[model samples]
Target chain A: MRLGRRFVIAVPTLWLLLFFMVPFLVVLKISLAEPRIAIPPYSPLWEWVNGSLKFNINLENYSYMWEDSLYLNAYLSSIKIAAIATLLTLLAGYPMAYYIARSPEPRRSILLLLVVLPFWTSFLLRVYAWIGILKTNGILNAVLLWAGIIDEPLVIMQTDVAVYIGIVYTYLPFLILPLYANLVKLDDTLLEASRDLGASRMSSFFRITLPLSMPGIIAGSMLVFIPVLGEYVIPALLGGPDTLMIGKVLWNEYFSNRDWPVASAVAIVMLVIMMIPIMILRRAQARGAEI
Target chain B: MSEHILAAETKPWVKGTDRPFVRIKGITKMFGDLAAVKDVSLDIYRGELFCLLGGSGCGKSTLLRMLAGFETPTGGAIEIDGQDMTGVPANMRPTNMMFQSYALFPHMSVEKNVAYGLRREGVPKGEAMQRTADMLGLVKLDGFARRKPHQLSGGQQQRVALARALVKQPKLLLLDEPLGALDKKLREETQFELIRIQEELGVTFIVVTHDQEEAMTLSTRIGVMDAGRIVQVGEPREIYETPNSRFVADFIGSVNIFDGEVDVAAPDLMRVNTSEGPVMCEPVAGLTARQKLHIAVRPERIRLSRTPLEAANTMQGVVTEVAYMGNLSVYRVQLPNGQCLKVTAANGLHEDNPITWDETVHIGWSAAACRVLVK
Candidate 1:
C-alpha cells in the first residue's frame, strides 16, 4: 500500500519534470543559440562541413542588448506602468474589500459574488467593452456631452492613462479577493482594543488595519504586477505607438522583425525583473503561513 | 464661591452617594425576533467579582457585552461610575473585556500587546514600556515579554490576555469564560489567582461562564441565567445550600429531586408527600400551606446502613451499582418504590465503606437534610 502511494505521488513529479523542467532547459539552450539572419530566417544548430565538428559560440545577442536603448526604455516604462497600476488598484480595492468583509452575512456573500462574476466572462470581452467606454466618442464622453458637461468629446482612449485604467480594471478582482479574505480573518477585537487604547477611527486604520493587511496587499500587488509586466494585448489595444512597453517591443521583434534571439532576450530579462517581486511575495506568503 | 456655599449644599463629587459603581438598568437586546437579553437590571459594586453563570445561549455573554459597550441595549441604559454610556462605542467605554478565545494579537509580542492600549491613549514610549513591564510582572510573565502569544502555552497566553485587559485599568473588567481555555488543573489554579488579583487591585470583575464550578469557585456572588433572564442571584453557598426554586437546585448541583405537595407547613419544618413515601423537609420561610412544591435532597446528605433501622422514615433499597472513586464511593440504589437514589459515602481511613452491588440496604436522612423547593 505504501509503495502504491509512493507511485501515485512520483507519477505527477515525473510528468512535471518532463513537461515543465525539460522545456526550460530547451529555452536556456535556445537563449544561447547563434542568431544568423539568413534565408530560412533561423540559426543552424551546427555547421558541419567536410565531416568535421566545429563548436561555434558567440555572446553577440547579450552584447547587442547593452547597445539597444529602446530595449532599456521599454524595460523602464514597463516597470513604471506596472507600479502605478498596482498603486491605483490597491487604493481602489482596499476599501471595497473592507466593506465586503465587514458586511452582514447575506450581503457579504452577494457582494463577493458580484465582484467575482466579472471574471467568469471572457477576459478579451471585458477589455473590448472598455474600448467602447473609453474612446473619443465613447459612452463616457457621449454622456458628458448630452449632459452639457463637455463642449466636445475628449480624447480619452489610446493613451498611457487608458493603459493604466485597463490594467487596474482587469486586475481589481485579483487584488480585492485576497485582501478581503485576509481582512475577514482579522481579529475584530484588535480594532476594539485599539479604540479602547485611544486611537480614533482614522488612526486605527493607518496603525493597525493597514499594517496588518501588508501580506495580502503584497500578494495582490504581485499578482497584478507580474502579468501586467508581460501584458501585450491590453496595451496594444489601449495605448498609442509611443507607449513603448517591453511587451509591445517584444511583439514587434518576434512577429514584425522576425528576430527570435533578441525577442528571447527581452522575454528572459522581463522574467528576471518580474521574479524579484515574486520572490519577495513568496517569502511574505511563507511568513504568513508560518503564522 | 466655596466660602459663599451654604451649609446644606454638597460638592458635585459628593452629590452621588448611593449609586452603584456600575449599574445596568432595564437593558434589553433583541436579535431580529429573539430576545437575547431582556430587561435585565443589575448593580455591580466596586471590588466585587460577580459571575453570570448559565448554560449556552443563556444570554450571559450578551449582558457582558452590554457592560463592555460592544452591544447597545435595545432599551434602557448602562452606567459605569455614574456616567451614562448608552451610545458609547466599545473603544470609548471605560471598560475592557477578556474574550473567551483570549483573542490576543497573534502578530504582537506580549509586551507590545499589553502596551497597545496605552500607546493608543498617547502615552509616551518610555512610560508605556514601564507599564507594560509592570503588567507582565503582575501576570508573572515578565520574562516572556518578547515572546509572541502563540509562543506561550495556553495558561501563559491566558495570563497575557488578562494582563492586556487589565493594563488599561478600566472601571469594570468583563471576562467571558476567562478560564475556559485552560486545562482543569490550570483552571483551578488560575481561579484562585484571579480572585487574589481582583482583591489586590480592588477592581470590579463581571465574569460570564457556563461552567458551574468556575462560577462557584471564583465569584463572590453568582447570577444564574436561563434563556435570557436571570433565574436567581446569590452567593455560591446560598445558591447551593438554600436554592429558592427547583431550577436553581437542579442547575447548581446534582440533587435527588421529587415533585411533591406541601401537606403540612410550620415555622421550622414541613411534611411532603413524595412518590417514595411520606418525607418531612425543613421549612424555608415565606412558604404558604397547600403550595405545589418540589423537594430536593443532596446525595451526600443521605446515610446508608446494612441493618434495618427502626425510624420514622426509612427506605429499603438494593445497591444496583457501586463506583469507587479515590476519595469517595458512589452507590446507585434502587428503592422498593421503583425510584433510583444516588448515595455518596466519603472515603476516610476505613471510613464508611458503602455496600456492594445487589446488596439490600436501608437508607435514611434527617428532616433537616433535605431542602423544600418551590418552583
Candidate 2:
C-alpha cells in the first residue's frame, strides 16, 4: 500500500488495538487465572518457581460457570428479554418515525426534536423516576384505581413488566433516531405509485414502506438489542429477585462476591454471546446496501 | 364549442359512443387559499391519447391527479366508465397513473413491480406472472425482469413504470409527464411506443405535459390550460392552426401578434386596421365596426422575399436577425413601426433562394393564413 493510504488506515486500527483488543486480552488472561486472597486477588497463569518456570492455567472459573444453573438461566432470560424489548421498541418507534418523516417543514423538525429531548436529562435520574411511577400505590396504579379501572393497586414494581417499561422508555430514542433518518429519505411518490397500481393503503405500506425501511429497522434493532442484552441498570432497579439477567449476575460475581476471575469469565462469555447478533446484523446491513 | 364538434367529427371513438369515457364536470381543487385547479370541465373519448398541456403550476397536473383519485375536488363531479367517482380512492378507481418521477419500487425486481397491482387484486399467481411477463415484453423490457430499479437505466426504469401501470389493464391510464425524463431521441421513440401500446390495448390515455411539441405529436387532442383554468380544448391541428384566443396562439407556438381593430366584419371576409397597416383576415363572428381585437399569424405561414408582392397582407421590413437551422431558416424582420415579425422558410437544397441579415425584405401571408383572436 501507498504511504498515505497506509497512514489513513492505521489510525482506527491502532485505536481499536490499544483500547479494545488490549483490554479484552487482559480479561482473557484474568479469566484463565485462579482466585487468590493475596494482593492482586488472582493467581497468575505463569510464574517462575525456584529455578524452572511454573505454568498454572486454571479452567475452574469457566467450568463452574458452565456447570451452574443460575448462570445458564441468566443467559437464557437475558436473550429473551433483549429480543422482546427490541421488538416492542421497533413496533412503538416505527409509527413515530413515520409520522415525523411525513410531517411538513418546521413541524417535522419540531417532532424530531421532541423525540430526542429526553436525552438532555440524566439517564439514571429518568430510570429512577420510573420507580415512582410503576411501584404499588404509585402514580399509574393510583390513577387506574381512582378511575375505577382496577380493583386493587397493581404490583408492577420489581417485576419484568417494570423492567421492560424502563428499558423501552430509555432506549426508544435510539431506535427512533435512526429509523426517522431512514424514513425521511424515502420518496413519497413510491407510496403514491403503489396506490396508483391498485394496492390499498395497508398493502402499499408493507410492499413499499416496510421493505425500504429494512436497513433502519436492522440498525435500530442492533443499537437497542446489543446494549439491552448486557443491561444492568434497569433490571437491578425495577426487577425483583426472580429476574435473571447476565448483567446482574456478572455484577454480583464481580462486586459482592469479590471473585475477579469468575467475573472476567462471565464478561468474556457475554462478549462472545453479544458478537453473534452483531455479526448477523452487519451482514444484513451490507445486503441492504447492495439493494 | 364549434371546435369540440369539429374534433368529435374526426374521431371514430367519439362517434361510436354518444357519451365520453371520462367526463370531468366543474372540478376544482384548492390548496389553503390558493386554487390549483378551478371549475374545469372536459370530456375525453375512449382510446384517445388526450394531453393536458400547460406551463408549470397551471393546474394541468392537479386535474390529472383528480382523475386518478389522488386528489379530491373541492367542488363538482368526475365520472369514469359511467360510474360517479366522488369518494373512491386511488386504489379502487379504474385508473392507473405513471408518475413523472417514474416511481418504480427500488427494492423489488422489475417483474415483481409489474405484478404488484395484480397481486393486490387477488389475481392467481400463475396468471399474474404471465401478465407481468407479457407487459414487460410489450414495453420491450423482457430481459430486465430480474434486475432492481436502481440497476436499470433511466429509460429502462421509465419502461418498468409504464409496464407496472399498464399490467392491470385499466380503463383509463393517467400519465404525468410520461416522457419528461428521457432524452430527446429516446423520448421520440417512447412516444410512439406509448401510442402503439395505447392503441393495441384501446385504453383511454390522459397525459399531462408542458412540452407543447410532445403534446402535439403524441396526443389525439390537447387541452391548453392557464392560471387554474382550461383556456381551450381541441385536436392538435386545430389547437395549432385555429387557436381560439391570443393566449392559446401564443402558448402553443411562436406567432407574430398584432393588436388590431375591426374596420369591416363579415362571415366570409373581414378587414382589420392595425398599427402596421390594414390587415385582411378570414371571417370572425360577433365583431362590430371599429371593435378591438388581436390578429396572429404563424411564422411558418409568412413568406419572405427580396421583392414586394402584390398581396393583401404584405409589409416591408428589415431583416434584423437570421438563424439558419439545417432544414429551415428563420428570420426576425423588424417593421418600420418597431413591431418585429418572425418568418420561417424551408431550405430547399436545390433552390438558390437566400435571405440574410440587414436585407430589406417584404413579408407577406394570405388572408386565409391570418387568425382573429377575440382575447
- DockQ scores for all the models shown? 0.59, 0.76
DockQ of 2: 0.76
What are the Cα lDDT values of the candidates?
0.85, 0.92
TM-score of 1: 0.93
Model 2: per-residue Cα lDDT over A105-198, one tens digit each: 9999899888889989999999999999998978999999999999999999999999999999999999999898899999988988888888
Error of 1 at B135 (Å): 1.0
In candidate 2, which residue pairs get closer than 3 Å at backbone N, Cα or C atoms, i.e. clash?
A: none
Off by over 4 Å in 2: A1-18, A45-59, B1-17, B263-271, B350-353
- Pairs with backbone N, CA or C atoms under 3 Å apart (clashes), candidate 1: none
Per-residue alpha-carbon lDDT of model 2 for B325-352, expressed as tens digits? 9899889999998999999999998776
